[model samples]
Target: MTRGYTGEVSPGTPADVRELGTLTISKLSVGPMDNNAYLLRCRATGEQVLIDAANEAPRLLELAGDAGLAAVVTTHRHMDHWVALEEVVATTGARSLVHADDADGLPIPSESLVEGDRVRVGDCELEVIHIVGHTPGSIALVHRDDAGGTHLFTGDSLFPGGVGNTDQDPVRFASLINDVEQKIFDRLPDETWFYPGHGGDSTLGAERPALPDWRARGW
Candidate 1:
């Protein structure tokens, strides 16, 4: 189901999904930018993965609870994305993980991830894909569930109506758009659910129709 910035995806206690095997991806709105911080949980094993700890440290810590926070993954090293990372790691004692290209932004040491790198949390395995338009180290996490649906965690590379901005170099924006079209847009199934770092969740099917317009608009 598509979710917006309204209420939490699953309010109260966690809800279990048979196919996902206790997996939950909760979005936390943070900073003045409305950056998205995801809380991924493995229901069976109670293992968790926190993505982009931007802010709201107290709430994040409470959300993590006693689960074994396996890793803290960052899509890039932008200040808005990594600002609260140190605080989250300190509170949960979870190791931080980022692409080798973006590892310098983290407060602590981080492992370099690449396209084929697989991160396991409980029964779920997230495959890493590098789509470097927004930043040199931008990455997306793709997970194939037993229920036959694909979940894509696109940090800042691809969004609902646009792509990540090329703040450092305008030329890189073209490369970023090309990467999203070839690597992410074309590879995933039409039904794939896209969980972006900002805005609401949309499907590959929903976003596909707008690609040409986005490209024309130079997004």
Candidate 2:
């Protein structure tokens, strides 16, 4: 039942009770880095897709529960985010989904995704938003509701208070900030929910007012 997090908490274990309208979303905080793995299951169709699949394969598998896993979507080409990628995919026989730009680094075969592409989990459609900077192919999956509510799954792009780390690369940092501002902040409403790849949750409203300060910091 703990789906959208507005603050940080030591996530206990994998759970499948978080309901998002007709869909069910579950999370498992795995790996040494505490990477978060999420399972988005369509309650109507019993089909699901996983995000990250970082580590602790058994726990992640269990999170899949009875819902059929259709695919594994990697937010980016981060080592922490996909350390258990092969393990999860092999066991589930799920297709690996990665952005086309970051596909070269993955150890397994993956079908490349791009901006504006639609990924279906059961009958729910998730739109891919390409966010470059944290990693060239980093993407955010967005679920919009008929009532105008929105949920954004941002891997390492936009975080609770700032954009993902850029290794002090000014060019990369600038690009990331630009995309987060123009593509995300400028476009999405303040009420949109943001679930980062690591750590807890935050809303666009909570983080939006501080964008200027974050940009100036050049982190």
Candidate 3:
């Protein structure tokens, strides 16, 4: 089940919540452009994990509460994804985790994560899968089972109706697309839910059918 909170203006801005089984994903709109940030919580243990601080640390902290944060995970080092990292970390005191390739670009550089690595929060585990199309170090997080379903936290790689832009290096974009097809699409069950960086949530089942068309359009 999913829930949404809109236009509840707070000093730090409030976020929308989507409950999936034992996990609750809080989607926050932060920064000047209202970049999306996520908070994943294990309902059973009350432990939480944040993804991409973006901006509005206070709001995120308020959302995280005293349940305490386990870690702050980033999909890449883009400024939009980490601009408010310092404030969040300072407020929550959570460790920051990112792909090793993009660790140098982090706001508060800390431990690095590699492909196939798993980060655990209470009884929940997120598998890190490198899907580097938007950036050399971009990645996606997959949770095998949560509330009787699978979930994916796709940073900037795969969106609801499209994929990340290929404006950087053509070769890199090609490689990213290939990785998504083989590593992500091929391996995961179609029922998986997708929590993208900047759009409404979708499922692997909802997205797979559109891949061929997206690929044909050279996205």
Tens digits of per-residue lDDT for model 2, 1-219: 354633343445545245667666676687578787778887778898999978778888877866547999999998888988898888888999999999987879899999999999887888999999999999999988554378899998988889999999999999999999988999889998878898888899999989999988997
Q: How close is candidate 3 to the true structure, as a TM-score?
A: 0.90
Best by TM-score: 2
TM-score of candidate 2 against the unseen true structure: 0.93
lDDT digits (tens) for residues 21-121 of candidate 1: 34776776665677777788775777889888876676667767767477889988888888788888877788889999888767778889988799887
Candidates' C-alpha lDDT:
0.78, 0.85, 0.81
lDDT tens digits by residue: candidate 3, 1-219: 753433232224557676767777777777575577888898789899998887777777878888868899988888888988888888778999999999899868678999999988778889999887788789899987645588888888988887887785667667877888898889989888787777567777888888888777677
**Each model's TM-score, in the order given?**
0.88, 0.93, 0.90
> Regarding TM-score, does 1 or 3 come out ahead?
3
Candidate 2 lDDT trough over 10 residues, lowest sum = 1-10
Q: Which stretches of candidate 3 lie above 4 Å from their native place?
A: 2-13
* Candidate 1 C-alpha error for residue 85, in Å: 0.9
Number of clashing pairs per prediction, in order: 2, 0, 1
Winner by TM-score between candidate 2 and candidate 1: 2
